[model samples]
Target: MTTIMSSALGFASNRRRRAILALLVVEALSLAVISALHLSGVIHGGTRPYNPEAAGIAEAVIGVVLIAGAVAVLSSPKHGRAAAQAATGFAIAGFIVGLTFTIIGGQPVDVAYHAIVLPLLILTLVLSLPKPRDLGVGRDQGPVSKSQ
Candidate 1:
């Protein structure tokens, strides 16, 4: 579609797009740090009161998913929006689940940070993404949406 193509090509009109890109970078870095913490046993926010091993595994999985999503975005600028959305999903799940775990066994501040802050950031970025229809050549306007 023209919208996606134009965004892919220039994306000059919306300055927020750059903010989105920056957030995506932050997400990638956060995930990597989380992965390192879990795998290397350097998790933050006080001592582990619950099952650290399980938490570590979960964190690693989330890290991998986010990294894969980032790769998808970087690999194809024209289709990066979808990739970013997918990454957001992983971020949402990780934050919620991690929040729950922290609330049950860790500090209240950790709970607040995970439950309130992280998800809001992720959702903000997700909502900021341009819809596929905005791409100008959406499936609805293509051969698939046409009746035979």
Candidate 2:
């Protein structure tokens, strides 16, 4: 069981995976922390009432997706790539949702934090994504070599 857990988590050792993990972690943490702050009255007042519990639930799903994507990429690149893509989408969506909240008169701190966090998420997602060349789909191949 210990070995199995290690195997599942082994991908995080790779530098690329680690970078992605950092971004996901920070995004999740920001939501969780801000939610706590909202509940605690450190941040209050918005068009939409701050719902920390709801935010926590969303963060939990994002966290699961993040961990699963990282682990899946290790065992199967095909599935892992898809998972990573989905994870990237989720990250970006979360950032956009943060912006939407601000637009709707949410807390100023939410916008300020999103300003800092969104760039990190974007950078990591950009790095994790497959380049067209990686899929043998970029640039001119010059000539196709025929083994036949």
Candidate 3:
């Protein structure tokens, strides 16, 4: 019974991790699009409502982080876990900074978007952190047996 429950939980965790990876990929693409739009001057609003410079920086940084995070989550037994953790930390920090900026001088729409997107991004980062054994590789115990 306990083994069955453990297996179920393991399966759920892997599913959640994969979902998080998918979310990160989507976010990376979204950021890339936003960055491209900003660069092309196609999605312009105004200085207070939409600062292209700041938006470009945010988009580029978030896109890079999300892509790196997805790659880390997909790979295993390497610097992937550490990279995911770093991406989580970066997302948290970016959320705080964005919130602060919103409170200071951002418009309502911009502030609302930041408030919503930042938390969701943080959630994805949190969900991406999986344990080593959950990856279903092996333990660092004794050598493998040659049994039938």
Candidate 4:
């Protein structure tokens, strides 16, 4: 019974991790589109970034980072967990700031984009957060003691 329950929990965790990866991919793609629009002089908004070129460059870099994070999340379990956490946290911060700026000083299009993306980023972060370890999930030992 315990084994079955543990397997179920493990499956759920894997599903959640995959969800996080999918969200990250979506975010990366969205950032790429935003970057392209800004760089192409298609989206000129009244906001903190007076220079659309610089903002667009930054967005492109962020998108690249997000793509890297998605790749990392598909790696080993420990590494993937860390990558997911970092990626989601960074995206959440960026989106929140963008949302605030858009709401205060930018166009409605910008506002709507930020508003929609921020919550999804938050959800990704939440899902990426580590949970308590399951008993006998993988190895019998958690980690070796340094003093040992």
Candidate 5:
């Protein structure tokens, strides 16, 4: 029974890990497209004059970081968790700043994009957090057992 429960938990963890990776990939692709659109002046919104090139470049960098995080997650869950956390945190901060400017600059499309993606990023960030076991929770302080 314990073995069966362990297997089930492992399967669920794997599924959740895959889902997080998929979200990261989708987000990176979205960022790439958004950056390209802005760079091409196709995403111009509102009357405020701002530098689309700068915003596009910033977003492209974030996308690259996200891709790296995804690759890391695929290779090693332990290290990848940190990478994903950093990437998502960075993205959240960037989006918040971007959203602030977008709202103040009166860029409705950009504002909408931030609105849609920001929450998803936050969710991904939360989901990628380490489990209690990973943080030494409920861990034995005595001599380690072979099974452990």
Candidate 6:
């Protein structure tokens, strides 16, 4: 019975980890598209002047970071949880910053989109913070633990 329970828990944890990884991938892709759209003038916002080159550069940087973060989370046996949580937190912060700036600049549509993204990012962030023990995985006291 104990073995069965442990196996079940491990499976659940793996699923959760995969879910977080998927979220990161989605977020990265979205950022890439957004940057492309802004650069291509498909999405217009007065708050942030559109600069295709700059947007592309920014998108590339964000993509690299997000991908790296996702890889870190997916690969680390013990610190995966923390890596995912930190990635989520970073995403939340980015959304908040973008939203706040857009609102201050009086871009209604941009603000609305940011508001939506912010909540979703927060939700993912919360999910990422769950302890490994909570998922029936062994306790990990790494320096990068998101619970800290």
**Candidate 5 per-residue lDDT over residues 1-148, each given as its tens digit:** 2211221123126666788899899999999999999989887755554556767888899899889889977887556667778899999998887777778774677878889999999988988876655445456675556798
> By TM-score, how accurate is candidate 5?
0.79
- Which candidate number has the best TM-score? 5
lDDT by residue for model 1 over 10-86, one digit each (tens)? 33224445455566666656656655665576654545554455666776676666666656555666556566667
Report the number of clashing residue pairs per model: 3, 0, 0, 0, 0, 0
Model 2 scores worst on lDDT over the 10 consecutive residues at 1-10
Ranked by lDDT, the better of candidates 1 and 5 is 5
Q: Tell me the lDDT of model 3 at 124.
A: 73
lDDT of model number 3: 0.64
lDDT of 2: 0.60
- Residue 111 shift from truth in candidate 5, angstroms: 0.5
lDDT values of the candidates? Answer: 0.59, 0.60, 0.64, 0.71, 0.77, 0.61
Q: Would you estimate the TM-scores of all the predictions?
A: 0.61, 0.63, 0.63, 0.74, 0.79, 0.67
Q: For model 2, state the Cα shift of residue 76 in Å.
A: 5.4
lDDT tens readout by residue for model 3, 5-111: 22223323456656777777876786787668766777555544447568767877978987887787687424444566677678667657755765666556556
TM-score-based ranking: 5, 4, 6, 2, 3, 1
Could you say which candidate leads in lDDT?
Answer: 5
Q: What lDDT tens digits, residue by residue, belong to model 6 across residues 16-73?
A: 6677788788878877876676667776646444333454455556666677768876
User: For residues 1-148, what per-residue lDDT tens digits would candidate 2 score against the true structure?
Assistant: 1211122223223565556656655666665676666656666666764444455455456656666666666556435545666786786786687577665676667778778877876786776665544444434665445762
Worst 10 residues of 6 by lDDT: 1-10
Model 2 CA deviation exceeding 4 Å by range: 1-14, 39-41, 49-64, 71-78, 138-148
Q: Which residues of candidate 4, in runs, are more than 4 Å off?
A: 1-12, 45-51, 133-148
For model 5, what is the alpha-carbon lDDT of residue 138?
59
User: For each candidate, C-alpha RMSD in Å?
Assistant: 5.6, 7.1, 8.9, 6.1, 6.3, 6.8
